[model samples]
Target: MSGFACASSCGLIFKSKESERNVVSLFQYDGLRAVESIRLGAIRCDPKSSISTSAAKCGRIKAMASPTVSAPKREKDPKKRIVITGMGLVSVFGNDIDMFYNKLLEGVSGISPIDRFDASEFSVRFAGQIRNFSSKGYIDGKNDRRLDDCWRYCLVAGKRALEDASLGQEVLETMDRTRIGVLVGSGMGGITAFSNGVEALIQKGYKKITPFFIPYSITNMGSALLAIDTGLMGPNYSISTACATANYCFYAAANHIRRGEADIMVAGGTEAAVIPTGVGGFIACRALSQRNDEPERASRPWDKDRDGFVIGEGSGVLIMESLEHATKRGANIIAEYLGGAVTCDAHHMTDPRSDGLGVSSCIIKSLEDAGVAPEEVNYVNAHATSTLAGDLAEVNAIKKVFKNTSEIKMNGTKSMTGHGLGAAGGLEAIATIKAITTGWLHPTINQHNLEPEVTIDTVPNVKKQHEVNVGISNSFGFGGHNSVVAFAPFKP
Candidate 1:
C-alpha cells in the first residue's frame, strides 16, 4: 500500500486490487500544467471507491472523498510562464526589426566588401558589415573610447531592449531591483581590442598596451556592465559557445526567471569579429568564402557551388519576464518563450559528429522541454552556415528528429545575414519571432541548387505567408556546441 505522507496522517493511500503488497504511491501536487502532473501520477484512484476503505486508516483522503477524485494535480504556476516582452537588435540589414526582416524576405544579402580594415590582400575579402552604430544615450564619449565595439553593442542593445519593454529608469525604480538580471553574452568579446593590444605590444612595447585591455576584452563584462548600468542586482553573466552563444544565453536567462531567481532578464548575444585578425584566422582554417567577385551570392547555404560561411557581426537582445511579472506591470508581451536545450557533440572540436547524434538529440530535448508535441511546430530557423559539410549535417540531424513530417517548414537565415558567429542565433531568433507576429517566413535566398539529401521544405528563394503557431530556432557552434530554442504565439 502507498499513501500521502502527511504530518498528521501517514499511511498507504493506494494499492492494486489484486494484491495488498503491490502498493503504488502517487506523487502529488506538482506546480506544472495539468497534463504534465497527470503523466507523473501514472495511476488513477477514485476516492469514493478506493479511498473509502482506507479513509479511517488515513485521514488525508477525507478531503478528497469525491467520486471525481483522480490522481493528484495542481494549477499551473504563473511564475514558470516565460514570455518575451521586448526585442532589440543590431544587424547589417538594419537595426529596425521590421526593415531587417523585410530585406531578408526580399532575398537581400547583407554580405559585402569589408572596409573596417583594408582586407584587399586577405584570402577572403568580404563580410556582413553594419554600416554605422552608436550608443549615444547609453554611454559618454570618454567611456565609449575606453570600451570595445562589442561592449558598445551590448550597451546599446540592452538600452533599446529596456526601452522596448518600457522598463526605463522611471519604471524600473518601481520594481524590485534585486530580482532583475542581465545575461548578455559574446563568443569573441572585444576581438578587435585584443588584436589591437597585441599589435601595440609588439610594435611599441609591453607598456604600449592600453590599461583598458583586461576590462574590455573579457566576455563577462558585457553582462556585468549592463547590470551595473541598470541596477539589476540579480544573476549576471555571459556564455561563450561560438555561434551558439545567443541561444545558450536565451536558454539560461529563461531558466533563471523560471527558477524564481529573477523576475526579469535582459538576455542575448553580441559580437564584432570582422577585424583583419578575425578574417585572417578563419582564412587560415579555410573556413571563409572566397567569392570576392560575387560577394552577395557567396553565402549560399545548400547550393552546389557554395564555398563557405561569410562572417558577420552584430548584437541581438530580448527582455524576458515571467508572465505574472509582465502581466502585473501591464507590459506589452511580444511572444512566448516556450523552451530551449543545449548539447555537445564530443566527437570533434570544430566539426559536428558525422552521425548527427548531438544535433538530433538536442532538438528532441528542446521539444520535450517546451511540453509541445511534434505536430505543433510549423517552422524552424536552421543554423546552416553555407558550409558544404555543415549544411548537410544539420539537415540530416533534422530529418532524424522530425522524420516523415510534412507539416514542418524550415529556412536558413544565414543566406541573407551571413554567419554572425555568436550573434547569428540572436538575429535568427528575432527573425523567427517576427514570423510569429507577422505571419511571414523569410527565404533561404541562394539555393539555386538544393541538395538531394534535404527532403524537407527549405522555403527557398522567396518569402511566403504562413500562419505560424509555434516556431523553433537552431544554432550550432564551433567546439561542437548545439543549441535549440522553442517559441509560441502569446495566447493571453
Candidate 2:
C-alpha cells in the first residue's frame, strides 16, 4: 500500500509500476501538462491535494493554469501590538480601581442628589456626583484653581494613569518623550467654565469674563493640557463624539501604535457635568430620569419601569502602549486591546436609527477588525442608558449581530454608575477589562423587571461568576455615534 500511489481525496488507487508511471509523473507537471498527462491513463493525485469525485467517470484529472487556490494572500501587519497597561479614573464610587468595581459588584448605586450645586429647580435633581475631588498631586494648585473641573479631571486622570503604567516623570525622562501622545477629551469641555462665563457676561458685561475663559472653555484643552504636561510631541488632540468620545480616543490611540506613529498614548475621557447648566440642559431635553425620589434605583437599563438616564460625572483615562515599548519597560499589562470600530446612524441628531443597521454593522466590523468570532464573546458591556428608545434600540442591535441566543451575557453597568456622558466608554471599558481579570460580572443593580426585548441574560441585580476571555464595551452618543472596543485578558 505504501508503494502504491493513491488519490486519497477521490479514493483513486494506482500502482507504482512503470505501466502507471504516466499517472505518477503527472503529479509533478504543470496544470495543463498534468491534464494532458492524466489523459494517458491511471490518473493519480498527491494525498495532500484534493481530487474531484468526477475523476472516476472522466478517468482523468483536471488541471488549472494557476499555482494557487485563487484567494489573494493577506499582507501581514508589521507594527507592534498595542495593549492597555494601566487605567485610572475618578468616579462617583471612588478613585481606586478595586473600590470602584467592588461597589458595582455589591450592586450599590453611586447615584445621589446633585451636591455640586442647587439642582432643586431642575427636573432631574440627582446625579452620580463625584465627591471629595482634588487634583493637588496631578496638577499645580495654582493651575488647578485656574482651570475648569473638566481640565482638572483630564490632567488628574491622565497623570494617574501614567503613574499606574509606571510612565511617571522619572520614567518618562529616560525615554523619547516625543513618541508618547495624549487624546483625552470631553463632550462638553469646560461646560462649567462656559456656563459661569456666560452667566457673568450676561449679568455684569463682557468685562466680567475672566482672561483665562477662552483657553479653558474649549473642547480641545483636555488633550492640549495633557500633551503640554507630558511633552508628547506625537499625534495629540481631542475628539468629541458625545458619549462615544472615550472609545473614539481609544480606537485612534491604538491605531497610532499599530501604524507605527507612536509608542505610547494616554487616551480616554473626562467630564464634570453635574453642575446647574449640565443638569438643566438635559432636563430641558427631558433626557434625565424623573425618579428623583429613589436616586439609587434611577439608572435602570432594560427595566420596564425605567424612565431615563441618570447623569454621571467624572473622568476615566488609560495608558495605552505598544507591546514592544511596554515589554521593554517591563510594565505591568492589564489587558490586550484587540480591535475597535466606529459608525454613524446619520438618521437623527438625538435619536438612533429605527432600523438598527448602524449599530449592527459597527459590531460586526469591530469583531472583524479584532479577528474574533461572534460566538467567542461570552460577555458584553451594554451601552443601554435606561432611556426608552435608546435601551431597546441597543438591545435590538445586539440581537441582530449575536444569534447564539443564550451563550452571551450582557450587563448594564450604567445601572450602578449612571451615564458618564463622554466618559462613559472609558468607565465601561474599565469595567469590562476588570471583569476579564476578575472572572466576575458586575450586576445591573436596578433590573427589577427585565424587558421582553432582552433575550440575552443581563446578569441582573447581583454579581455573577463568569469567565471573560474576550469582551466588548459599547458606547453611543446623542448624535448617533456608535463605537465599540474589543479586548481580552493579557496572555503574553
Candidate 3:
C-alpha cells in the first residue's frame, strides 16, 4: 500500500497493512494530516474513507490547516496612453511644421544650388538648404560657437516643440522633471565638425583644433544639451541606425513610456551634412542628383526619368507624452503613435534587398504592431528618395504588402523637401501627423510620367484633402536599414 496526504479535521492517519510494518507519516500542514488508505496495487485511498474514523485510529496529528490559494494576477491599468502633444521642425522646405506642410501641399520644391559651401566642381551641385537660421538665438551666445550645426538644429527644434506643446517654463517647473526624457538621433552626427577638425589639423596643425571638437562630434551630446536645457532627467540617449535613426528613436521613446520608465519624451532627429564633403561623398557613390539647372525638379520620386536624391539637412521634433500626464495637465493632444517597426535588409551593406523582402516585412510588422489592417491605411508617406533603385524597391515592397490595396494614395515628401538622410524619418513623421490632423495630403511634384511596373498610386501635381483615419511613413537608408511608423487620429 502507498500513502496520500489529505486534510483531516483533527489528525493524521495511515491505512496500509494495519499489522504489517511501522507506520510512516508522509507530511503535515496546519490543522491537516497525511492519511494513507489501502485499496489496490501498491497503495491508494478509498473514495468513501471516513476522515474522522481514519484520524481517530492513526496517532500522527497536527494543528489547524490553512487553505491553499494562488495569488491574484495584477491587472494592467489602462489609464496611461501615449499622445503627440506638439511638433516642431526646421527643414530645407521650411522652418515650422505648418509652413513646411503648406509648402509641401502647394508642391513647392526647396532644392537649389549648393551655396552653403563651394560645390562648383562636384558632380551634384544642387541640394535642399536651410536659409537664414541663427543658432545663437536658441543657444546662449557664449556656448553657441562651441556646438556643431546639428546640435544647434536639434536645440531649435526641441525648444519649438516644447513651446508648441505649451510646456512652458512654468509647466516644466511644476512637473516631475525626472520623469521627462529626451531621445534625439542623427545618421551622420557632427560630420561637419569632424571634417572641419580634419581640415584644421592638416592646414594649421594640432594646436588649431578646438577643444570642444570631441563633444560636438559625438552623437549623444545633442540629447545631453537638450536635457540640460529643459531639465529632463529621465532616460536620455541617442540612437544611430543610419536613415532609420529617427524612427527607431521615436519607437524607443514610445516603448519607454509603455514600460512605465518615463512619462514624457522629446524625440526626433537632426542632420547638417550639406557641406562639400557631404555632397561630394554622395556624389562619389552616384547617390545624388546632378540636375543643377532645374534644382527644384531634382527629386522626382516614381518618375520614369528620375536620377537620384537631393541631399538636404534639418531637424524635426515632437513632444510625446503619456495620456494620463497630458490629461492631468490639460494638454492638447495632436495625434497618437499607433506603432512602428524596424528591420535590416542584411542582403547588402548599401543597396536594399533586390526583392524588397526586408522592406515589405517591415511594413507588415509595423501594421501588426499598430493593430491595424492593411486596408485601413489611406495614405503612405513613401521614402521614395528619387533614386532609381530605392524608389522602385519601396514601390515593390508596398505592392507586396498591400497587394490589392496597393492603389492607396501615396506621396513622396522627398519630392518637395529633398531627402534629409537621418532626419528624413522625423520630418516625414511630422508631415504624416499634420496630414491626419488637417486632412490635407501633399503631392509628388515633378513626377511627369509614372513608371508602368510601379503599381502604387502616386499623388502627383495637385494637393487634395481626404478623410484619412490612418497613415504610415517609411524611411530606409544605407547599411540596409528599414523603418516604418504608423499613426492614427486620436480617439480620446
Candidate 4:
C-alpha cells in the first residue's frame, strides 16, 4: 500500500491506499508542505498494482506501509464541557475581580495622569495604572528584581485564580500536573524592561546588562513563569497579536482542551507597558486620548468628542477546566466558555476594515461556534477603545451581526479600565463572567454625549441589573486582528 500526504493552509492530510484510513492534523505553521522519499529496502509492492501507479505519479513514496495508521477519532462526549472555574484580575480599577466588578457597576473611571513615569512633556498624559500592586508579595525574594512588571502581574493573578478555584497545592499534588496548562499573553511584553535594558547596554558594556533582561522582555516568559509558580506542566505558550493578545490566548487554550491535550488550563493575559516610551509611542501615532484636563472623561467611546484610548496596565487570569474534571473534583464553575472565533482584516496594519467586514464575520463565527443565536445575546462588552474610526467600525459590525437587536444592552469596559492592550480580552472576559453571575451589566462611563453615528443603545452611567443568560465580548487590535468570545451562565 502507498500513502500520500497533502498540505494546505489549514492543516495536513495523509491518505493511505486503503481508502478507509486517513489522518488530518492541524498545524500552526502556514507553510507546510509534503516531502516524499523512497526507502530502498522497505516492503516492495507489486509493480502493476494501482498503489504503485499512484506512487509513480507523486515524486516518490516510501516502500514501507505498515497497516494504515489512523488518528484517534474525536468522540462527542456530551458529558464533557468547558467552563470557567475561577477568575482573578489586577486592573487599574482594582486588584481583585470583585473590586473591579463593583467599580464597574458603579461606573467608576480608573484613568489618571501617568504616575509611573514623568509624562509631562508628552502629548498624552493619562493612563490606567494599577495603584497598589506590590511585587514583593507575589514574587520570590530572590527573583523579584529579575522579573518584569508583566510577569509580576501574571504571578499574582495566576495565584489568585488558583486559590479562587480552590485548587490548592494539596489538590494539585493529587491531580495530574502534566494535564494542566498555561496560556498567557501580552501585547508589548516588557517594553519598560526593554527600554531600560537598551539604555544600560548603550551606556556600559555587555556585562552591565542584567542576565534576566532577555527572559524578562520576551512575551512567553509570562506563561513560563506562571507554569513554574503554579506547577502546571501542560501545553504552555504566549500569543502576541498586538492588542488582541489575550483573546487569542483564550481561543488557543480552549482548542487545547477541545483537542484533549489538557484537562485544566490557566489562561489569560498580562500587560504592563504604561511607561514613558510606551505612552510616547502611542502619542506619536495619535492613538491616545489627549483630554489631559479631564482625564476621567477622556475615554468616551462612541461619543462625539471621543479622542483615543488611554493606555492601561494590569493582568487577568482565568482557570478553565473540563466539566468532567470540575465535576470530579466538585469545583465551583463560574461560567461556561461557549467558544470563540478569530479573524484577520488583511486590510491594514493598524486600522480595521472600514465597513467592519472582518469584525462582523468574527462575531458571526463565534456565535455559530458557540451554537447560540444572536437574539439570545443579552449583553455585549465592546472593544470600543475610544478611538474614532475603530469605535465606529466595531459599532457597524455589532449592528450587522446583532441586527434589530442593536438596541441590546452594550457597555464599553475600556471606559472604566482604560485600554489594557493585550490584557483587555482576558480582563473583559472576567467582566462578562461577572455580569452573568451577578445579573449586572457594567456601564460605559464618561460619555457626555453620544455620537450621531452610533445607533446602538449603550448603557451609560450607573450599571444595569438584568438577566443575562448569554454575553459576547469583542476585542480588536492593531494588525487588523479581530477576536470575539461568548460566555453563558452555567445551567448545570
Candidate 5:
C-alpha cells in the first residue's frame, strides 16, 4: 500500500495508489480544475506509483505556518501619547473637580426647579440648573459683567484647567506659548447674549444692541477668548455636535498633540443653556423631563419611569498634553487618553437609531483606536439620558459590543448631573477618570425600576468600589452624533 497526502486545507490522506489516482482523475474534470490545481500543488503522491504524473508534482507538502499575530500598535512613544494633566469644570455640583466627582459618587442629585427665570408658565419647569455661579477670580469684573454665562463658564473652566495643570502665570511664561492651543466648545453658544441682543433689537432699536453681542454670542468666541488670554497661537477652534461636543473636542485636541501641532491643549466644552430661551427651546421640542414634582429624580436614566432628559447647564474642561512635554515638566498626569471615536447615525435629527448600530460601531472603533480589547474595558460611563428612546437605545448598543456584561459596571453620570448638552462628555470624562483613580464607580441614581432590556450592572442607585482596568465615557448628541472616548490609568 502506497500513501498520498494533500495538505492545502483538504487534509486528505490516501492509503492506496489506485485510490489517489481515482481521486486525481475525478478532480481533473472541467468543473474541478481549481481543486485539481490545489491538490497537484499541495499533494505528495507515492514516489514509485506509475499513475503519478509530472503535472501532479509529487513532492512532500510542507504545511504553511500560521501568520504570527501580534498585538495592535498602541501609542508608546512619549511624543505621540496624550495624557490628561488636569481637569476643571463648572458643574452644578460645584467648580472643583474633586467636589464634582465626590458629589456624583455620593449619589447627590443636582437637578432642581429652574429659578433662573420664571418657569411657572412652561410645561417643563425644572432642570440641572447651576445656582449663583461666580467668576470672581477667573474673569475680570468688566468682562465678567458683560460676557454671557456661557462665555463665563468657558473662561472659568478653561482657566481652572490651566491652574490644575500647573500651567499658572509663572509656569506658562516658561513654556512655548505658540505651542499651546484652546478648543473649548459650546452647543448653544451664548444663548443669553443672543437672546438679549434679539430682544434689544426687537423691543428698542437696532442701535440698542451691544457691540459685544456678535462676538460673545458666537460658538468659537469661547475658544478664541481663552486662547487670546493665554497667548496660545496653535490650533484654536470650537466644535458643536450638540451633546457630543465635548468628546469631539477631546478627540480633536488629542489629535493636535499627537500630530505635533501643540504640546498642550486646553480642550472641553461649556454650555449655559438654562436661560428662558434655552428652556423654551427644549420645551418646544418636548425634550425636557416634566418631573417638576420630583426634581431629584428627573434625570433617571435606564429607569422604566423615566419620562425625558433633564436639560442641564455647565462647563467641563481638561488639560491634555503630550507625554513627553508633561514628563519633561514633571506635570501631574491624571490619566491617559487612550483614544476616541465619533460616528453619525445618519438616521434621525434628534432621535438615536433604535437599532443602535451607530453607537455600537463608535464604541468598537474607539477600542480599536485605543489599541484596547473589548475585555479590557471594565467600566462604561454611558450616555443614558432618561428619554424613552435614548436610554434603551444606548443600552442595546452597549450590549452589542460587550458580550459578557457581568464584568462591565456601567453607569450614567447624567442620572445625577443631568445632560449638559455640549458639556456632557467632558463632565462624564472627568467622572470616568475619577473612577479610574479612586476605584469608585458612581451610581446611575434614581434607578428605582430598571427597564427590562437593560441587563448590564448599572451600579444602580448606589456607588460601587471596583478596580477599573479601562473606562470609557460615552456621549450622544442630537442630529444622530455619537462619541466614545477611552481612558486608562497611566502606566509609565
Candidate 6:
C-alpha cells in the first residue's frame, strides 16, 4: 500500500475513500520537517468523517475543526497594475518600433557579414549587425564618440522611450523625478571598451587605457547612464542573468511599481557584444552558426539544419508606469505587464536540463503570478536560439505547460535578429506587444525543414493574422537562468 506523511513535526497519515491502498494527510505548519513516520494502509476514514475521530486514532494530535483550506487566490489591483506606455529599440532593422516590426513581418533577414571588424580569421563571420546607427540629436558629439555602444544604445533607447511615454524633457521638468527610475541591464556590457582596455594593458601599459574603462565596462553602467541622463533617483539598477537579463529587469521593475516604490520605470536591456572578443568567446564555446556562405539563413530556430545561434547586438527599452499614474497623466497605453517570473535549472552552466523541469516550472509560476490560465496564452515569443539542445529543450518545456498546441502559435524573434544575449528578452517583449496591438503574428523565418519534434504551429516562413489574447515571452540563458514575462491588451 502507498503511504503519505504530513510535513510537520506532528506527522500523521490517513486513508481516503478514493483508494484503499493509498494514504493521504493534509495539515499546515509554521515550519517544515521530514516525515519520519509513515503509516502504510493505516486507519481508513472518509473525507467527510469527523477530523476529531481521525486525530484520536492518530494520537498526540488535536485536529482543527476546520477542513483543509487552500490559500486564497490573488487578484490584480487596478491601482497597482503596471502598463507598457512606450517601447524604444536600437535594432538591425532600425530604431523605429513600427518599422522594425514591419521588417520582421516581411521575413527580412538582418543577418549579414560582419563588416565592423575583420572577421576573415573567425569560423563564424556573420551576425545581425546594426548598420549606420546614429545617436544624432540624442547625445552631444564629444560624449557620443567616447561612449561604448552598450551605453550609447541604452541612453538613446531610454530617452526615446520616455519621449514615447510623453515624458520628454519638457514634461519631465514638471513631474517629480524621484518617482522615475531606470533598470536597463546587459549580459556583456561594454565589450569594445573592455577589449580595448585589455589590449592596451598588454600592448602598451595601464597608462594607455582610458579613464572610463572601469565605469563603462560594468553591467550596471547602462542603467546608471540612463538614470544619470534623466536625473531619475528612484529604484535604479541593473540585473545580469545572461540572456534572461531583460525579463528579470522587467519583473523587478513591475514589482517596484506594484509596491509603490516608483510610479514609472525605464526598464529593459542593452547589448553591444558583437565586438571581436564577444564573437571570439561564443566561437570558443562553439555556440555560433558558421554559415558564412548564407548569412541570411543562419539563425534558423526549430529547423532541422540549424547548427548554432548567430550573435546579434541591440537595445530594447520600455516605459512602464502604474496604471493609476498613467491614467492621471493621460499617457498612451500599449499593453499590460501582467506579471513575470525567474527560475534556474540548477543543472548545468552552459546546457539546459534535458527534462526541462525548471523551464516548465518557470512558465507555470509566471502564469500564476499573472493570474492567467494556461489556455489564455495564445502567443509565445520563444527563446529559441537555434542551438541543437536549446530549441528542443524549450519546446519540451513549452509542451509541459501548454497542453493544447493547436491553440497556441509560437515564434522565435531570434530567427531574424539572432541571439542578442542580454537584450533578447526585451526585443522579443516588444515584438510580443506589437503582435497584441496589430493582431498579426510575425513569421519564424528560415523554416525550410521543420524539426519533427516541434509540434506547435510556428507561423512558419510568413506572417499570420492571429489576434493575441495573452502572450508570454520566454528567455533562457547560460547558467540555466530561465525567465518568462506575460502581457496582454489592457482591458478596463
Instruction: Kindly list the per-residue Cα lDDT of model 1 for residues 1-492, writing each as its tens digit.
Output: 000000000001122343345543231111111111101111223334322222211111111122442422211477988999998888897677788888887778998999888887887999998887777778889989888888888888788889899999888888799999999888888887787888999999999899987778888898998888888898999998888889999999999988889999999999888888777877765667889999999988777787778888888999999999999999999999989999987865565665677888899888878876555677889887877667777777776766543656689898888888778888989999998888777778878888666666677776656677678999887666889999978886
What's the lDDT for residue 19 in model 3?
Answer: 22
In model 5, what lDDT does residue 421 have?
83
Off by over 4 Å in 1: 1-75
Q: Give me the overall lDDT of model 4.
A: 0.74
Query: What TM-score goes with each of the models?
Result: 0.84, 0.84, 0.83, 0.83, 0.85, 0.85
Instruction: Kindly list the per-residue Cα lDDT of model 4 for residues 106-157, writing each as its tens digit.
Output: 7778988877777788888788988877765567877876677888888888
Task: Score each candidate by Cα lDDT.
Answer: 0.77, 0.76, 0.75, 0.74, 0.79, 0.80
Each model's backbone clash number: 2, 0, 8, 0, 0, 0
Model 1 Cα RMSD, 1 decimal = 18.5
Model 2: pairs clashing at backbone N, Cα or C within 3 Å? none
Of 2 and 4, the candidate ahead on lDDT is: 2
Model 6 misplaced stretches (Cα beyond 4 Å)? 1-75
Tens digits of per-residue lDDT, candidate 5, 1-492, equal 000000000001112445455654211211101111111122234455331122221222121212453435778999999999998899999899989988887788999988889989988988889997989888889888899998899999999999999998788887789899999988888888899999999999999999988898888999999887778888999998888889999999999999999999999999888888888876665566788899998888878787778888799999999999999999999999999999988865555554567888999999988988777777899887777666666766777887656667789998888888888888989999999998777778898897667767787776666788789998877666788899999999
Measured with C-alpha atoms, the lDDT of residue 408 in candidate 4 is 63
lDDT of 3 by residue, 78-156 (tens): 3345789989888876577778898887788888887887777777888888888876556898788677888989998
Where is model 3 more than 4 Å wrong at Cα? 1-80
Please list all clashing residue pairs in model 6, or write none if there are none: none
- Output the TM-score of candidate 5: 0.85
Q: Of 2 and 5, which scores higher on TM-score?
A: 5
Q: Would you list the clashing residue pairs of candidate 5?
A: none
Give the Å shift of residue 272 in candidate 5: 0.3
lDDT of 6 by residue, 252-299 (tens): 999998988999989999998887888887776556888999999998
